[model samples]
Structures are given as C-alpha cells and as structure tokens.
Target: MKLVVEVKLLPTPLQAEALEATLCACNTAASWVSGVAFDRRTYRNFSLREHTYAEVKTRWGLGAQAAQHVIKKTCDAYATLRANLTAGRLGGPGSKRHRLASGKPIEFRAAAAQPYDDRMLSWQLDARTVSIWTTRGRLKGLAYTGGREQLATLARYRRGESDLVHRDGAWFLLATCEVPEAQPNSKPVDFLGVDLGVVNIATTSDGHVMAGRRLNRSRARDHELRAKLQRKGTKSARRRAQRRRRKEARRTRDINHKIAKHIVAEAERTGRGIGLENLTGIRERVRLRKPQRAMVHGWAFAQLGVFIAYKARRAGVPVVYVDPAYTSCTCSRCGYVDKANRVSQARFVCRSCGFVDHADRNGSRNVRARAQAFWRSGAPSTAPAALTGLDADGTPQPAVCRNASASRQ
Candidate 1:
C-alpha cells in the first residue's frame, strides 16, 4: 500500500524565500498554461506541453524538470476538473455550481503545492536535511523533522514524487512511500462489527462506544471562533481563522489515527475480521435541521473508515462492509424491526421480544450478523478484496462459533 509521510522543513530564511518564489513562479506559469489549454481545447499533458513548455521555462526561469512539472500540474488540474464533472460531484449539468465549474478555465493558487521528482529533491536521513531545487538555485542543507515512525518509514519505503507545500507560514514535504502489506488472514473465528455514528464516533459489536461529545464540543467551539473571525472581515482575522481550522483538522486526524490503530491491534490480537457499516451517500440521503447539518457536514466518517481499512490491511486483518440500512432500528436479539425500537439516541428497546440494549451496540451487533451471513453466503463487498483485505477464496472458517459474544471485549 502507498502512504504519504509528511515532514516539516526547517529552512533558513534565505531558503524559505527561494522556495516561496519558486512556488509562486510555478503556479503563475501553470495558470497561464491553463488559459492557453482552454483556448486551444488541449488538455493532454504531452500535447499541452508542446504549446507551453518553452515559454514556461523562459518566462518562469524554470529548469527542464521544473518546467515539465509545471505543465504537467496544469494538465492534472484540468483532468481533475473533468473527472469531477463526470462524477456529478459539482451537481447536475444544469445546476449553477456545475455550470460555473465547467465554464471557467482552471486556476492555480500562488501557494499551491508543487511536485518534486527525485532529480529535484534529495533526502539525507542521517543528517535530517533535504536538498531541493528552487527558482533561485538548488538549495541544500534544509533541515527537516517528523515523528520517529514517519522518519523511519520515509527512509525505508519513500518513493516517487514529493509535494512541496507552503501552508500557514510553514514549509512541508509530503513524500509517498510504498509499504508492504502483511499476508492476508484467510481464517477467522468471527467478525468485529463497527458501527459509525455522530454521537458515538464508533461502536463495536463488542459493546464498546467511542463517544464524540468532547470532540464535538471542541469542534463546535472551533466553528464558533471561525464564524466570529469571519464576521470581523479583517485580514488578520481571516488568517487566524485559517490557522484554527488547520488546528481542528489536525486534532481530528490524530484522534482517528489512534482509534484506527487500537481497533486494528485488537482485531489482530484476537484473530478476527472487521465489519464496517457502508455509509456511502449518507449526506445526500439524510435530512437534518440547520444546527444538525453543521455537525453532520463536519463529521469525517469516511476518513475514519479509510483509516480503519488501511490499518486493517497492514495487520493482515480482513474487513467487510455490511449494509447499514435499518441496522440502527433493528432488534439484534429477536430479529424484529421497528422505528420505535430505538427509544432514544442511546437506548434500544425491542418491542417484539422486550430486549433492551444500547442503540449503537445493537446496531453494531446487527452489522456483525449481516457480515457473518455475507461471508458464509458468498456476498461480495463493493470494495475490492485487495482494499478490504479479503482474498478470492475467502478466509477459512472454524468448525463452530467459539465465542458467541466475542465483540464485547
């Protein structure tokens, strides 16, 4: 699997100035190339390069590699826009959002990240420094820092292009690394069902609930601060808002990483597969009040799911996506389904059998049941086996269920 390892650069003042200039020059040239491409209706990298290559090099003072990267970046931006239009991410063709996106030529921000090939960037792990190409010259001995694990991963598996990013007055490099995956576990006792929710970030069929109240409160505070800053309508206020936004995002990402790591570790330790709810198109399918919408929209459910999947893959743990419809309201103990079964956000009462349990826990149990059935009945998940950590022949099953309430742990 390919992962990105980010390292913060500690560049000298002069080096920072050079990098800033380089980024500005590259993006400026890319914007010009985009306009040219729009005029000629040419978007292919090589074809577009034919029209802008020489000019980009001369005008931006870019070397051969930098010039090529600039043109390629411009082409990529247009390609992404085309993909968004095709995917209906911008809405219907007749919608104003879609029309506005399709009508204008793509533009690149002055501070947009620039990709650096190996020729343009070199890393020294022992010295903790990087030598990189810049508009001023090839700048060397730019110190960098990262977590120990990230640094180790970068040294061992780093490959391909690294993106040079300038954000919030700091310089960083996002290096791609190709990490090897563990052998897939074909045999499993049972599946660990994970139910994702707004109130509870994740509830395992094992009856573990990761409540989101504290995180939600922190996010609410951040949102309020941003709104207040925006209302000020000043440059400094906007800058502060941007920094706060980044801080909130980092906090969420760190929490998700920890949660995913713990879940994967537990599954690996107990030799069980993971079952996750399929919550695709949830935002479009669900309706909420204005206040609820902000919380829902800000929730990073998909990111959490992705983290679980990749971490699971690395641990040789199989993951399955179960149908989420009615899982929340269905009775896990008696197989009864009713809207009223969910007495409140946190409680579930099955009317048929008079069973009671935590709502999210019950939902997770349903997820586990569906996953077990799907595995036995040979129902393929929407995601490919490579991504979900399953195999073509499926994992070998035990003779019988050993732990009936295994998810509780």
Candidate 2:
C-alpha cells in the first residue's frame, strides 16, 4: 500500500528564505499558467506547456524541471476543479457556487506545496539530511528529522515524488512510501464492530467505550474562544485564533490516531476483522437542532473510519462496511427494529425481548452481526476487504502513515 510519511526540514535562515522565494515564484508562475489555460481552453500538460513552458522558465528564473513542474501543477489544479464540478461538489449546474467556481481561473497560494521529483530532490537518510533544488541554487546538506520509524520507512520503502509543504511557519516533506501489506487473515474468529458517534467517539462490540466527553468539552471551549477572538477583531486575536484552530485540529487528529491504533491492534490480536458503518452522506442524512448540529458536524467520524481502514490494512485485518440504518434503534438480542428501543442517547431497551444494553454497544453488536452476514454471503474475494469501498465522506484521502511525532525535530 502507498503511504505518506512526513519529515520536518530544519533549514538555516538563509536557506529558508531561498526556499520561500522559490515556492512563491513557482506558485506565481502557476497562477499565470492557470490564467492562460483558462483563457485558451487548454488544460492538457503537453499542450499547455507548449504555450507557457519557455515563458515560465525565463520569467520566474526557474530551471527546466521546476518550470515543467509548475505547468503540470497548474494543469492538475484545473483537472481537480473539473472533477469537483462533475461531482457537484461546487453545486449543480448554473448554481451560484458553481458559477463562482467555474467563472474564475484557479490561483495558487504563495505558500502552496510544491512537488519534487527525484531529479530535483535527493534524500541522505544515513546523515538525516536532504539536497533539494531552490531558486537560489541547489541547496545541499539541509538537515531534516523525523520519527525513527518514519526514517526507517523512508530508507527502506520510500518511492515516487515528495511534496515540500509550508504550513504554520514549518517546513515538511511528505515522502511517499510503498510499504508491503502483510498476509491477510481471511478466516477470522469474528469481527470487532465499532459504532462511531458524537457523544461517544467509538463503542466497540467488545463493550469497550471511548467517550468523547472531554474532547467535546475541549472543542466547545475552543469554539467559544474563536468566537470571542473573532468578535475582538484584532490582528493578534485573529492570529491567536488561527493558532488555536491548528492546535485543536492536531489534538483531534491525535485522539483519532490513538483510537484507531488501539482498535486495529485489538482486532489483530484477537483474530477478528474490523467492521465499520457505511456513513456516506451522513451529514445530509442526519437531522439535528441548531445547537446539536455543530457537535454532529464536527464529529470526525469519517477521519476515524479512514484511520481504522488504513491501520487495519497494514495489519492484514479485513474491514467490512455495513449499512447503519436503525443500528441504534434496533434490538441486538431480539432482532426487533423500533425507534422506541432507544430510550435515550446512552440507553437501549428492547421492547420485544426486554433486553437492555448501552445504546452504542447495542448498535455495535448489530453492526457486527450485519458484517458477519455480509462476509458470509459470498462477497467478492478479489476485493480488498479493508478500505475497499469509498471512505465515509465519499472521498478516498491519501493514506497517511503517521507516528506520534512523525515531523518532530
């Protein structure tokens, strides 16, 4: 499977300035190329390069490979826009959002990430350094650092292009690694069912519940802080809000990672597959009050699902996605489906058989039963059980293999 491992780059002040200048120039040139492509209706790489290649090199003072990369990146941006339009992500045809998106040429941020091929970038894993091309010159011996596992992965399985990303005043290189998957456990004792929710982050069929009370409280505080900062409307306040938002994102991601790691590890240890819900269009399917909407929308159930899928894939554990309709309201014991079964957010009592269980736990058990049925019903053997279908949000994000401190120096 293809995974991306991020490593931090520690550059000298002068090197950092050069890197920043190079990125700005590349993005500026890409924006110009996008304008030309939009005006001329030419989005293909070769054809668009024919029109902008020489000019990009001369105008931006970029080398041959960099110029080519700039043009290709612009083309890719347009291609992505087209895909989004086709998928109605922007809006339906002639809608205001659709018109706004289609009416203008794409623009690249000055600090946008740039892709580097092997010809432009080289890694020195043994010395924990890198040699990369910059507008100033070929910068060599630029120190970089990563977690031990990430460094080992880079040394052993790193492949393809790496992206130079500038985020929050930090530089990182996202290196692609082609890690080999372990032999899958086709026959498992059972499936570990995980029910994802806003109140409880995850409830496994094994009766394990990872509550989200603390996380929710933290988010509420962060949200309140952001609102106050916005109301204050000062530059420093805006900056602090941005930093807090980023910190909150990191915290959420960390929590999801730990939860996913534990779930995958337990499933693998017990010889069980992982079962998840097919939560596509969940945001649209769910209806809640104004106050509850924020909590539900912020639920990162999709991210948690993706994390589980990727980790399960690496551990050679199969994952099955089952329909989630009425999983909460249905009685796991008597197989009776009724909305009245769920008496509250946390309690479930079966009206048919007088069986009582935690609502989320009962939902997880139902999910486990459905997954078992799906697996035994002669599902396709050629398909990869883990992450075979689209992710919860109807998009398959790049599988990121990250550690606790993958980019820490």
Candidate 3:
C-alpha cells in the first residue's frame, strides 16, 4: 500500500523564501510547458524535452533537475487530458467531454509548490532535515516534525515520490510510503453483513449496531454554532466557526477510524468477509425529505467504507459489495420483498411471512445473502458448510460467522 504522511516543516525565514522562489520558478516552467504542449498538440517526451530543457534553465532560471521535474508534471497532465478526450469522444460511460478538448489552452495556476522526484529530493543528514534542489541553489537545514509513527513506517517501506505543498501559512512535506500486500490466507467461510445508515452508523446482520447518536449531536452543535456565528456578524466569529467545523470533521474522522477498526477486527475473528451495499450514485437516484436529505448528505458512510477497505486489505480480509435495492424491505426469512415490510424507521415486519426484525439488520441480512450468492456463482466454494444462507429465524445458517458482531462486549 502506498500512503502519504505529511510532516510539518520548520524552515528559517530565508530558507522559506528561497524554497518559495524555487517553487515559483518550477511552476512557471510547468505553465510554459503546458501551453506549448497544447499549442503543438503533442505531449511527447522528446519533443517537450527539446523545447523545455534549455529554455527553462535560461529563461525561468530553474535548476536542471527542477526543470526536468516540471516537464514531467506538465506532460503527465497533458497525457491524462488527451486520454480523457479520447475516452469522451468514444462515448465511454461517465466520461464527459473536457472543455480543453475544444482546443482551448490548458491553464496551470501559479503556485509556490513543486513536486520533487526521488532524484531531486532526499533526507539531509537525518529525518529532521530535508534537502532539495532549488532554482537559486541547494538549500539545506529545512527541518520537519511530528508523524512519528508515519516516519517509522516510511523508513520501513519508503518507495515513492512526495509533493511539497504550501497551504494555510505552512509548508508541508507529503511523503509517500509503499506497503507490501499481505498474502491472501484469510479463507473466509462466510460474510458479515453491514448496513450503513444515519441513525446507526453501521448495523450488522448479527443484530449489533454502532449508533451514531454522538455524531448526530456533534453535527447539530456544529450547525447551531454556525448559525450563531453568522448572527454575530463579526469576522472573528466567522473564522472561529470555520475552525470549529474543521475540528468537528477531524473528530468525526477519528471516530470513524475506530469504528472501522472494530468492525474489521470482528470479521477477522469470525473468519468472514464483509458484505456492504453498493451505494454508488445513490445520492442522485434517491430523493428524500429535507431533514432526511441533510442527514444523509452529512453522513460519512463513504469515508467509513474507505476505512474498512484499507484495514481489511491489511488484515487479509475480503469485502463484498451487493446491490442495495429493496434490502430493507426484503424478508430475510422467506425472501418476500415489499416496501410495506419496513413498518417504521427501525422496525421491519414482513407482511407476507409475518416475520419481525430491525430494519437495518434485515437490510444487512439481505446484503449478505446477495453477496453470498454472488460469490458462490463467481467462485467455487471451498467450504460447503459456510454457505451463509439464512435460517428460519433469519440468522446465518453457518454458525462459524454467526453472531460475530453481537458477541462483542
């Protein structure tokens, strides 16, 4: 896995200004290259190299390595633009025609940052300081701090390039580290169904729920604070409110990380893969009441999914996405599907089968069933005893992964 760890830079005023100047030169070089590529209708390397290598050094006064990196950055952008234009012209699904494909010159916004490749960037003396080739000269003694664990991991698995970014009155080194893929030895026998919702962040088919009461309260508080700040009509209040909102987002992300860790640990303990709904494009397809829509939009289900996926990958666990249509209403016991089956927000009463259960749990069960069927059809089952079929009580027939979530203390 490739991950980027951001480290705070502690640079002297002179060093900061020099680095900023270097970044400006590189961006100027890149902007020129982008315009040339579009004007000539070619992003070929040798052509760009011939045009930029000497010109950037003399005109932009950039270092040799910095000029090369600039050419690489702009050429990559042009390559992507050309590929996207081709795909759009071919009518590929979800690929819209780019405005630049109409022959308008591509614009590269001026910025005080540059992407440093391995050839131009390296640690100076130790992890504290880093050295980079700048336009003026090689600047050293640029120190960075924090991210102790990330630094350790980078030392263990450093393999990729990093981008130096200047944002919010700070210079940050966004370093990337690659992790080796774990061997696929999980041998999952079944799946643990997880239904994501607003009230409850996650509901497992095993009848356990991770409630989102605290998250909802935090959102409400944030909204109230925002409204009050707006009413204050002061510039400082507005700024404070913005900072508070960012803090709330960070807090919510921390909680989501914990929840995902717990959920993946449960799946690993049960020797099961996780089943979830394929909620792609759900926002555009589903319309809800004003309050419900806000809750839905405010929720971080997508972030939770990403967290689960990465954690599960490292743990050698499998994840499956199933269709979401009618999952809440479908009867887990008798396979009966009707919108009326979901009698309330939290309750599910199957009219045809007279079965009762929590709505989210029912949805989870349906998701698991679909995923099981999908896997069985796609891949030969190694263990027939772990078929993930629902029993008469609407629980998993396979006992190996049964009650995995509910068993937690």
lDDT, candidate 1, 1-409, per-residue tens: 6667788899888999999999999989989999999999999999988899999999889999999998888877887689779979899889999989989888888988888999999999999999999989889899999888888888998888888888788998888777788998887789999999988999898987888999999999999999999999899999999999989987887777777888888889999988888887789899999989999999988667767877777789988888799999999998999999999999999999999999999999999999888888876664543333223453311111111000000
Candidate 2: tens digits of C-alpha lDDT, residues 1-409: 6677889999999999999999999999999999999999999999999999999999999999999999988888888789889988899999999999999999988988888999999998889999999999999999999888888888999898888888899998988777777799999899999999988999999999999999999999999999999999999999999999889888998898899999999999999998888787888887889998878878887667767877787899998888899999999888999999999999999999999999999999999998899889968422222233334443323432211122211
Question: What TM-score would you give candidate 2 relative to the actual structure?
Answer: 0.93
For TM-score, the strongest prediction is: 2
The model with the greater lDDT, 2 or 3, is 2
Q: Which candidate number would show the highest lDDT if scored against the true structure?
A: 2
For each candidate, what is the lDDT? 0.83, 0.86, 0.72
lDDT of 3 by residue, 43-74 (tens): 88778888778988899887677787788777
- Model 1 ranges off by over 4 Å: 384-409
Query: Any idea what lDDT model 1 has?
Result: 0.83
Stretches of candidate 3 off by over 4 Å are 79-103, 124-127, 216-252, 289-300, 380-409
The candidate 1 region of ten consecutive residues with least summed lDDT is 400-409
* Cα-based RMSD of candidate 2: 3.4
When sorted by TM-score, best at the front, the candidate numbers are 2, 1, 3
Q: After superposition, how far is residue 91 of candidate 1 from its true place, in Å?
A: 2.2
Model 2: how far is 236 from its true place, Å? 3.4
Worst 10 residues of 3 by lDDT: 400-409
